[model samples]
Target: MSDDANRHDPAPNLVLGDADGGRLAENIMHFARVLRTAGLPVGPGKVLDAIDAVSQVGVASRRDFYWTLHAVFVNRRDQREVFDQAFHFFWRNPNLLERMMGMLLPAMRGEEAPEDKPELSPRVAEALAGEREPERPQEQEEEEIELDAALSVTDREVLAEKDFEKMTKDELDRARQAIKRMRLPIKPVKTRRYRADPGGRRADLRATLRASARQGGDLIWLKKRSRRRENPPLVVLCDISGSMDRYARMLLHFLHALTNDRDRVHSFLFGTRLTNITRHLRDRDPDAAIDKVTAAVEDWAGGTRIGESLHRFNADWSRRVLSQGPVVLLITDGLDREGAAGLEVEMERLHKSCRRLIWLNPLLRYDGYAPKTAGARAMIPHVDEFRPVHNLDSLAKLADTLSRSESAATGEMVRWKKLAA
Candidate 1:
């Protein structure tokens, strides 16, 4: 291959570091730290590797320097967008740098308000704001008392109600941890099989006779059995389309907790198509699990094909997963890019297959909400429950609803179904 072709090819690896060498090297180290702060997996070894790689390909040409660093740092497809934004901001791209700097300083009275600029990820924004995590010693300082709940009650309450769409970087981090600590308090469903229970109503004649035989028929011992109970299987179909972008990440954390905390839980994320992520979420580490999901899902934050996704689920997955009468959670905003084609039939089929169907919509958080869209109208009538799932309080309420002996749609929600009908 020619030298030019070889120049285009690159190596992988990057790290956070400090430079003792000189100004140029120090700047590069600082840049790598910025990327690390922005949630990239840059490490100490990668930092040394980045420095060595930069030495071979000098920073004379800006384009060459960018690509060299990109080769080392950008490992996954999803990392590209954050890497691009951080590069432009940290390297002082004249346009974005000047614009961002202007905002940091106070606006002069009567200066024309700046037009809304492009959105940056919360992680990127926080990193650029210089919010490095506080350092900790290898050993934590001994405390006489430590509270199980990290935050004060008022602060925790505030965090619980804050909308996921508007939460800051720190708030989001706390929310992710909170979701991991949560337990879905759903009650178990009874099965036809029976297990020995001392207080059971039904007599186990065979067991009683065997016990008496062991006692030489001198005494009769009564044995009892009861229906076996286990947590019902859960099938979660979550929308990851453009409209759901704000809530999807947080909800994914919720799904991950559900998968790890329960057995027979299946998670399917759908954008324009359905993708099973149950296996990925089984990873013990939340960050690693989410990374795998990000790599696997091809249609993140894309268009929605609600009817198409639901149809595929009913046709391919319903019988297999729903045979045990699992409770289904259909989480979406009901904005169908396909205009609700075949949505009603698919929704009805899904509802009938599962023991219970709960439609958890973020939009329902708003007061006086109704099924204004075609897809919502079609789907509302089929679900056994319609509930908002935007905040922690709502999630807690959902747990209570599931733990109850039985539940059905509220009267107000039923009115929506009637109107749609």
Candidate 2:
């Protein structure tokens, strides 16, 4: 064959027996890359696992190969969605590049659905469709099956666009799973006396005297050191109103982590009423604890009655949880649909009862936020510090603030006072 003919022929590089194997291996690698881009955490281990799974299953049929790799690589529920989307787009039999290109158009319009379903561009889709499918009965059946399930395509696209607001029951469940996996670095506050070493410090006089007495009352040197325990009680009041539904659920996971890690973390959730969930959060497993809390809370995603809730907390829970200069985390948006009278009184009481009352508001995530609302106005001055709690970054800041001795007071309170003029 002439050089031109050899170059034009697609099978020139293919060895007779290994032609199919080579193509399957190449496609698997490419599909793995797609899964990685779609946020499936497809690392070298998963890649190796995919290859082994494909080899064991035998690459004779496309459906077997697709499912074999999927069973090995897609572990988590959220990851399964991304993997399924990427797998369909990447392994298309005809007009793959065109389909991918259609997917990319939505992204360019700044309306790309959530990171749940990563789609490709039209140009890219056209490029991928370069290879034609072999005419086989099984291949035709697979194609027909896929076409019948086209409804899933629009569903994924909708999920991507809706973000958190449009999450389905299953998606919300997966989100909660994601939240559980998140690790919050909550350091314990150590007391001054706790740092002293029993052996190196002044001495344990009582122990030394006891030791000398065992020696038949001989003149023996004795040393003594006083010991004080370090236990910084954690007090958390989480808001569970409609406005804080998303944030409150996630925060509950964090609080569960905190409760299990520490000895004295008191947790309470409130919407229309106060419900102490310290015991519930203390359950060893976060999922079980959250389930227990869900069962206990009568007002999940209910109307906000912050004033009323806070008043109840101050009246009943404050004395029990606020002893030992406990650090207070007041998690709320401060958007009391009810009037601020009860909130103001409760805030004042809470501030006095705790060592520091740090207010965490999701509303503060916006840059131009002002405490113009009645609840914000009533509660701002009473809080030792005000901070945002909308995202992971904000939660990290909260961890830092909690670990430290002093609270980082923001000027939003000052801004609010001026605005009230």
Candidate 3:
């Protein structure tokens, strides 16, 4: 057993349920399982630590008990909200079954009581709404069900096209796994630097002489070199504001894949400020990397200051990270709190700094999306490409868009520009 298990508990006789002190430990284990099911990185170790912490601190004060578990389990800022919701639902009442049934079927209690509903995080909501086995009547016999389909679509196809925000827990898990295996087939761009090649148009007198010197100054062979080729640097500027929380979380998985698969990839997160998370994301373990990124970024799920954040990037980081014809992926909803003050100038400067600026907006998932926001209007004209980024299909299309040598002002962007103009 571990040290936690060996340690003596102060609340040895404390019994919240049928069991002795083990009841609390069992409850903590179940909570950890729920968290794992809800996409958290909670493990058995954390559960043990939580039990030990509660035992030492004593759950006399509910607030202290809550924070103790939070300190042990939650390692990232994004996870705090989910943990809070889970704690509220899990420990609200002594009767877990009654509380769950009450929340799930509020209509059964007549219309008198205004439903005391909480705005739960999606992961926590799904976990709390646990599966229920259907009850069968004694008189009923088992029957076979049949379906006649006119058309067919595979689950993978549906999942690829489904919006990230609308995915269930299972589907989201599959999508994360799919994202981990995704690779960007980026084409290499020609550079001024040269490398050794025999079939070169330009003659290399120096290389030819150096090779001939080995053969006693004999001019038996000719040598040549070709310009070096490399994939352009990828600079991602992701938005982590309140409105973008859901989509941003999913995109982080995609970004993690990109960081591991490619080189010269720089990532930045902006809410009210800009944060360079390239180093944090370099960890091979996606869960650990995201945890570190969350701990490092202070302004997540806050208000958006697009203009100010972009201005900061332009002033401090553009020259450092945006050199050598980099392709910039600006992931945002384009909602700015400052009404896009100086946004156009900064956007233009950023556009000029990079070879290609592709703006990925989750709001584009809406059929009636319009660039009515001041930030959108100012930034749209400066970006080379504008695309939807709400699904796996869209991300696949992004890879295609990057591979081809096409005009930046595509049809979708042209129409939007005309409407904004």
Per-residue lDDT of candidate 3, residues 327-391 (tens digit): 99999999998899999999999999998899999999999999998999999898888889999
Model 2 scores worst on lDDT over the 10 consecutive residues at: 1-10
| TM-score of candidate 2 on Cα atoms, chains taken together | 0.56
In model 3, the runs with Cα more than 4 Å from the true position are 1-125, 131-153, 218-220
Give candidate 1 regions above 4 Å deviation: 1-36, 40-113, 118-124, 131-150, 217-219, 418-421
Estimate every model's Cα lDDT from 0 to 1: 0.79, 0.67, 0.82
TM-scores, one per candidate:
0.74, 0.56, 0.74
Instruction: Give the winner by lDDT: 1 or 2.
Output: 1
* Residue-level lDDT tens digits of model 1 in 33-97: 87898778998877788878988987556567677788898776556767776765566432433
Report the Cα lDDT for candidate 2.
0.67
Q: What's the residue-level lDDT of 67 in candidate 3? A: 75
What are the per-model C-alpha RMSD values against the true structure? 8.0, 16.6, 7.8
